[model samples]
Target: MSATPPPYHQTAVRPDWRDLPDGLREAVGGRLGASVVAARTATAGFTGGFAAVLTTATGARVFVKAADLARQRHLADWYARELAVLARLPADLPVPRPHWALDAAGWYAVGLDAVDGRTPRLPWDPAELDAVLAGYAGVAAALADPPAGLTALGLPRLADLARSDILWWEEVAAGREPVPPLIPPARDRLPELVALESRLPGYAAAAPGLAHGDLRVDNVLLDPAGRAWFCDWNWLCHGPAWFDLAGLLITGYADGAGLDAVFAAHPAAVDAPPDALDVTLAALAGYYLTAAGPPATADPASGAGTVGPGAGPAGGNPAGTSALLGAHRRFSGEQALRWLAARQGWH
Candidate 1:
């Protein structure tokens, strides 16, 4: 990452307390054991899901997320999966605890103990980044030998998922997809990119364990005590610990931190392959760059032209998701690529 990095903030179009249906509101109140007095909608993340910190008449505050079961079944399923994952996490970890969940009035909602915290400020606060890294160190240590209960969930492996979903350089090299505009310098280097990303599956398989598959700054919360609490568990998977460390360091790299020293000093980097960081960056760059490509115009399912940003493709825009997701991906991809280029002197 350079002295300047792409913006990490996201402005979501979320529903307010008043927008919730009567039945849904009552259901949430019942779960909280009191009537609601005030609500503060969260401004982070790239989703349209109902996410807020609600204050009850009894002065109790809790975080709640709801999705319309009928209109956003996929989002509802994600919420359900996250609830289950949160329930199984170690009690002492900084991750939130899931208290309860309910289905009411065609909507599914879950409640969690709210933390008096805010997302980490960008430009990489040294103390805040230290807190996030320290917190993630503990998470990685615990997941290195994941509890049997979490393993019982039979979560997908990152190797398999990456091979299927993240390896887009191969597609670009074979002419199946267009080269992303952000990487015109990468046109002649697709083969090298492919080779770099190709090593990820093997490296991941060699030291397989639990990983916070989506370990980004937005997914972390810094408490008043300066502890980092990880959030958004729907993408949990089995992978190498260094994978999360690398992802976390992307922002650090963009913040102009001495990442080589920072990465080597981290506990998660122990026993990691010498080239692990490059592999992870290559895979991430390919994933984000390809995902951030121009929106599809044809509905692959119907073979007809479609409208909107995420219209027609295998991973096209789905309901209840954020529209700014593409912008986020583009920014992330550019950061990863720039960082990788700097490290490898590809510039």
Candidate 2:
């Protein structure tokens, strides 16, 4: 097995609620009432945008997350989409409940019910996986049919997403980028690999329901009782239920957890073709790699390393890079490539 890459840190830089423009803060305060006196920033996300918990003088609290479209044009769209999705999600889903939206002072912000929870422990605790999987089942059932409001949101389908993120082998083969050291096998077989990747766009299954387009470990939180609540509604979409299931399973995969065991227990896998899993994993890899910088320029051990800017004051925008963020991207991409490699035998 290849050595483990660095774990993804919750390095998202969020402004303290008070740091926001006075007008915006006043608007939020007026909406929630001026009783709010304490605000603390959370370093758990990678958005690097505006996110923090606001506590009222009376002890009421709300998790406020926002973005400055001027600096984060992409995040603005995501924030808008999140407001749309959260407003219409089924009542039974475990997402944080939205209280209000604030589009003021050159910002897009939303106040939500602050979840009292922690991220799932790494190394795939079986119990936690069980709870999250069960939550997926409920979500699948509640969303068996797309909500009337979502059908018009124009969310991308699975194949649509894959098309947006073509394989890295294609990039390297075309001289657009160099291959990373993590997947040396691809360098010599670019043609074969690229040809095989052509099948991805057509493998998208019919929309099973709503899909959490960006489901990953960091986006999920575990409550005190062990139930799971998925955060980050910015990437919600209408697609096969199994897409998010595959993502959650992939998180476990990176930790050396047995994906087969977990997949066997999910109803989403029922009657699903084996190739379905392959397609999801491939698309995920594509997404991660696309956000990363050029592949490793030298041996990682020699300290010729790259990093993602992470979610610093620059915000956790994908366009930024820090040594740590880069490793996380590479690590995630490597896991994805490994998962895909296991599915197909090379020529």
Candidate 3:
């Protein structure tokens, strides 16, 4: 079984509550109507943004994430976009509710209902994975036909996003990006990979719907009752309903789960193309491989190889500047490629 890369679980070096600017702190406290009595910094995911659960003297708690508007403008923009997306999301959706937002003291911050839960344990806890899959079923059903209010945000089409920002096979085939050592067969299979990835846009447009866009284990919270709450709304987009399911199952594939069976059983797969999973895997593998970064021939302005929270096209990683993120990307990409290879009997 492919193990989750340790780096994926420890990418953040989050700032403590006290490390925040005094002005920003004061503003947050004012908005919450109480000074923070205790703060527990969250240390998950690949961003250096300030995220924590803050408790007031009255025991009121809120999960807050903040970014310095000047130094981390990309993160700030992402935060702003997330808040907007959350505000527009369906009320019954299993996402945290935004409590408030602040744009003061050169920082942008938002408070959300603190989830009394933790990130799902890796290595595929069967029960937890089941809960997550069930949760996603609801998400897919709800978003299959998004309301005008939600779609009004003008999310990018999955096909357009994949073509312009996500896919990377063409770059690799052209020798613009390095071939990852683990996927040596990719050198010979470049033509097939490119063809599979090239089909994503047309496939996506044929069955378009709103999608979670960035559904990873790190972005899910398993509550005490074992319900999954999806987070990170900045990547929301107009896409095939099955897209997020394919992305979310990558870890399952890594854990040696029967991902083919799982994918076929998912409600999101109802109308998906017979080869949709293959196409998506190829595209995502390409995304992660290049997202690991520093490909000399990649367009400097495209920022395709970089990591972190800069939105590209509509929104995505502007640069893969973090070593931790690079490691996670490499691990994810390799796993995806390996899984696809196995499915295609590519050895």
Which residue pairs clash within candidate 2? 47-316, 48-315, 48-316, 307-322, 307-323, 308-321, 308-322, 308-326, 309-321, 309-322
Best by lDDT: 3
**Per-model C-alpha lDDT, please?**
0.78, 0.67, 0.79
Question: Which is better, 2 or 3, measured by lDDT?
Answer: 3
The segments of candidate 3 whose C-alpha lies over 4 angstroms from its true place after superposition are 1-3, 7-9, 252-254, 294-306, 309-322
Sort the predicted structures by lDDT, highest score first. 3, 1, 2
**Model 3: per-residue Cα lDDT over 173-206, one tens digit each:** 8877666545665658989999999999999888
Candidate 1 lDDT, tens digit per residue, 1-347? Answer: 12343344444557898998999999899888899999998887666789999999999999999999887776788888888888998888998889999999899999988988887887678899899989998999988888888888888898888878877888888888877765545546778888999999988878857998888877888898999999989888889889888887774443567777778889999989999988998888888777765643443223222112222213665544555566556666777787778788775
List runs of model 2 lying over 4 Å from the truth: 1-9, 166-168, 184-196, 252-256, 294-323, 343-347
Cand. 3 TM to true fold? 0.91
lDDT of 3 at 243: 81
Candidate 3 minimal-lDDT segment of 10 residues:
311-320
Instruction: Write candidate 2's Cα lDDT for 239-285 as tens digits.
Output: 66776787776654534565755665688777456676766666556
